[model samples]
Target: MSSFENVTVLTKANVYFDGKVTSRTVQFADGTKKTLGILLPGEYEFGTDVKEIMEIQAGELNVLLPGSTEWITISGQGEFTVPANAKFKLEVKTVSDYICSYIAE
Candidate 1:
């Protein structure tokens, strides 16, 4: 989907990595939540409390998923899933746009 509708977005941004990574919470009617964000070329590590699907809308990046030795490269658009209670690493090569959906275990 190019955009989201019928959702409520929080005004406050979720800032991380000294403002290099920022996202806003988007709440849906079904009680599901997602984050729309941008990553400005940097390395970042994140831990998840729930399963997450990261949809890369635009940009280039390498992802090291939990327990993976390989770094998956995404140049334009891609998607990856991270299990709950796991940590993943990212090396963003360019300004990246993404949507992250949090799923219950």
Candidate 2:
């Protein structure tokens, strides 16, 4: 499998993934959908056709996906995945520091 790692910085908006959404202050290690930390405030929603795995680390992050809209606060790090083609949205609440997220594919 090809390994890919990338970082995304959100200044004033949230990151939307088809139907899966997450806080911008979230980081995924390489190719996993794990969370690194919660850098800011936001909501994550997922569609039914979107499929992805995520991981989080470090600070803290609030996560939201389809079937559930409750906000999840995470600190240090964590991991999760989204289904395929889901309807997702994010609302940037407040952020003291810039949000950094990494993705590997």
Candidate 3:
């Protein structure tokens, strides 16, 4: 639903959660990197070394952020940020498309 023209693609990255999740890495001209991916219905945990902003492009997700017991719902076009060296858990209710931006710490 979005366009990222004139950007440099770094490489292809695949994350297999029993073939439930996968992603590709993209690099922009400004040294910013992002992962455009999809998540099948499942529960997953992810760790981050740098700050990251995850933008939901389609479908929905229930996320338990770092140090939180409450699960926050992120619908299509919604976003959430995770701090450096933090981790987050996600419950994917449906097939979800996402764009995860990596930020410099």
Candidate 4:
């Protein structure tokens, strides 16, 4: 979707990698939450407590998903999913914009 309506956006930012990566939580009415974030050119690893669907809006990157020997490349726009309680790696080639939706299931 191009935009989200009637959603609540948290004021506090989620920062990581010494401010190289930052995001804000967006809460929907259905009790689900998503994060809109920016990732600078760098390598980053993240652990998830829930299944996450990452929607890449812009820029380029390579993702190392859990139990994978290959790094998937995402340029401009792409999407990837990570299982709950798993760790994944990302190599951001450029300033990447993404929205990550936290799934309860």
* Tens-digit lDDT track of model 3 for 5-56: 8898756577788779999888888888888999999999999999999999
Error of 1 at 21 (Å): 0.4
> Model 4, range 1-105, lDDT digits (tens) per residue?
699889999999999999999999999999999999999999999999999999999999999999999999998999999999999999999999999999998
- Residue-level lDDT of model 2, residues 2-30, one tens digit each, is 23357544454454543233353434444
TM-scores, in order shown? 0.97, 0.40, 0.91, 0.98
Model 2 Cα shift for residue 86 (angstroms): 0.8
Report the lDDT tens digits of candidate 1 across residue range 65-98.
9999999999999999999999999999999999
Model 4 C-alpha lDDT versus the unseen true structure: 0.97
Clashing pairs in 1: none
Please list the residue runs of candidate 3 whose C-alpha ends up more than 4 Å from where it truly belongs after superposition. Answer: none
- Model 3, residue pairs in steric clash: none
Instruction: Give per-residue lDDT, candidate 2, residue 58.
Output: 43
Determine which window of 10 residues in candidate 1 has minimal summed lDDT.
1-10
Q: After superposition, how far is residue 76 of candidate 2 from its true place, in Å?
A: 1.2
Clashes of 1: 0
Worst 10 residues of 3 by lDDT: 10-19
